[model samples]
Target: MSADLGWWGVPLAILAGTLRGSAPFLFVSLGECLTEKSGKINLGLEGSLLMGAMSAYAISYLTGSPWTGVIVAGIAGMALGGIHGWLAQQPRVNDVAVGIAMIIFGSGLAFFLGKPFIQPVAPQLPSIAFGSWSSSPQLESALRVSPLFILGVLIAPLMQWFFRSTRWGLLVRAVGDSPDAARAMGISIFKVRLLSIMVGSALAGVGGAFLSLYYPGSWTERISSGQGLMAVALVIFARWNPMQCLYASLLFGGAQAIGPALQSVGVDAYYYLFNASPYILTLLIMIITCSPKRTLTGVPGALGQTQE
Candidate 1:
């Protein structure tokens, strides 16, 4: 692919990388989006992502079924999220503080438990070859897409619809926009927030599964590279909109692909620097979107607010 297209390979590789790399971002951002929409923030998804990766890899190795690994990973993430949710509900407790603790605890637990599975091989999730019709190997390789990625794509619109049209969605929105109003209407704020956090964390775990079972296809301590944390910034960038999260995730993925895409075309002079594009892009987005003078357009009103 690189030799055939020369400089053109950069864009093609980036497009391919966008499809491959964006899955994790997409899942994490969507998960975070759901959590934020229900009036909570979960910083522990970073830990969840790592735990999911480790658990998925270990489970796949043991069970010889990648799907089972994915399920276990989601369960692992849900456990961590459940802990955060329960602790946050305690009197005088801060959800953000609980989230931070979860990050430490989850990461440490994953690191401790994942040690033995580090060297084991696991079955990978299969891909659908979108480019099978093409004779060129590079094109075919570039177009080989993951089922999880496809699922993420479908989920974006579904989530958008869910938030717009469903009764449960309205309840979530009401809880996020004004907890007092939701409470006045007899909604159980604790249950809604807990469920949102758990569901979101499960999605984050699935994202982690994608990391181990698909792209890079291996278990590593640093596989996530802070993508879980970045999902928070991405949610803000997307204004808590599920469909917009998909676009923002793809942009991040493309940025991440720049370095390798360039390297594939023999442009390695600033490879490491290019690899930092996603982080740099994240920093820039945060700066631009989080300015005090610039009101965030679609932020949930109850976001970051402590439950009384």
Candidate 2:
């Protein structure tokens, strides 16, 4: 039930908005963080996310299980990353160009596969109920968030530890910063990048699945138009640290929720502009966080490399 939340209920609304908005980015940023950590940027994440959305929705509808759909979507995204890695390992096509091509292919593929399932309702994820603690109806509704949101929150710190403390994490950083150096030290740049992309793509796919099987339900040609793109930017803003990605993603998520929250409270004069707030905030965060000075600390050194 929607809360009778009045003007003072802004905090509750923001809380609700943060959960709703952040789930998608949580998935995408986590994925991009891995890819960038390996010193490669997979702009094709857009395609991967869209493809995952379609694949997840179709599978969920067919199988009557959202979790199963999520798994299949992740596999599809990894396959896409595998193709990107193989092509990138070749000299003929640039990674950027391949990524762009992948975007087109992914979008088209999502559209094509998604056509038949557009109207079919698929199995959706159940929300976590933390409402028992609250006595007020408004409070209960406010707490109706999902377990996946909590899952995303937990992944962030785990990623930070993996990056800062693990042997593989050091290897990933070493490869990103100096492939030649890493090569001399017995690390494989190609393998690292390939694995990173696959992991990132898989997360992106899961993120897409969240959109269709949880937040909105069902699917469409443009269900994930720019969410994937913004998430890549979020990874940069978070500086390749998974813990930071969590906070940054939630903030972006809050910005998106603001537009709707305002509209819901009978404020619509600037609703259209509110719709664009999230993207604008994303741009601003990237511009501020990606300055050369900040990037040195947060950005991967191995990004956009040319093998010699």
Candidate 3:
């Protein structure tokens, strides 16, 4: 797969990597988007990601069903999210502090529980072979896409529409923008925020499943690699828009794919540097988006504010 394509392999590999790599980002960013849209930030999603990866791998190995693993992963994430939401709602408790604690707790729990399943082989999720029409094996392999990625793509637009046209979406927006106003309008701010966090966490868990069951395809202590943490920045870069999240995810995915893609074409001198591209890109994006002079459009008004 590495030697056959010469320079042409770079673009193809990037395309393939984008499809494969973006799913996790897409799911995580979307999850974070929902949470933030409801005026909450889930810094603990990294923990949820690791927990999901461990849970999915263990379940898949035991049940021989990848889909089951995905479900369990989502549940695990929801549980963590629920905990974060509940704790953050306490009077005088800071959500950011709660989020940080969840990160530690979730990741520690996952690492402890995952120790037993580290060596087990698990069933992998299936991919759609879009490259079947190609005569070249490399091309064929490159075009194989994950069903989860497709689902994320479809959900992005649906989320956009939901936010724009649905009454429930309006309620969520109202809560995020002004809890006092939402309360005045008879909305349960607590319930709305709690549900949003759980659903968002569930999506993050599915992203973790994608990592263990599809791409890297294994249970490991380091499976998440900060993708969950980076997702916060991604959501900001996307301006809380689901469709923009998709594009940003693809960009991040392509950046991630560059290192291995270059190595495949025999460019090894700068392999480590290439692999650092995603992190570097992340830093650049945060710097650009977090500029003090620029007002961030679409940021939830109540985001990061202390609740009375």
lDDT of each prediction vs. the true structure?
A: 0.89, 0.82, 0.90
Where is model 1 poorest over a 10-residue stretch in terms of lDDT?
1-10
Tens-place lDDT per residue, model 2, 1-308, is 55476675666777877877688889889998988888777888899999898899999999998889989889989998888877776755567787888888888888988899998889897888788788787777667787767888888888889888999998988888888899999887789889988988998888888888887666988788688888888776776789888988888877877777788778879888887887777677667656564325767775776554
Q: Which tens-of-lDDT digit does each residue in 183-277 have in candidate 3?
A: 99999999999999999999999999999999988989998888898887799889999999998999999898899889977899978899999
Off by over 4 Å in 1: 1-3, 279-294
TM-score of 1: 0.94
Error of 2 at 148 (Å): 2.2
Model 2 lDDT vs. the true structure? 0.82
For candidate 2, the C-alpha RMSD (Å) to the true structure equals 2.2
Best by lDDT: 3
Screening candidate 2 with a backbone cut-off below 3 angstroms (N, C-alpha, C), the clashing residue pairs are 39-302, 176-302
Return the TM-score for each candidate structure.
0.94, 0.92, 0.94
Candidate 3, superposed: residue stretches over 4 Å from native: 1-3, 280-294
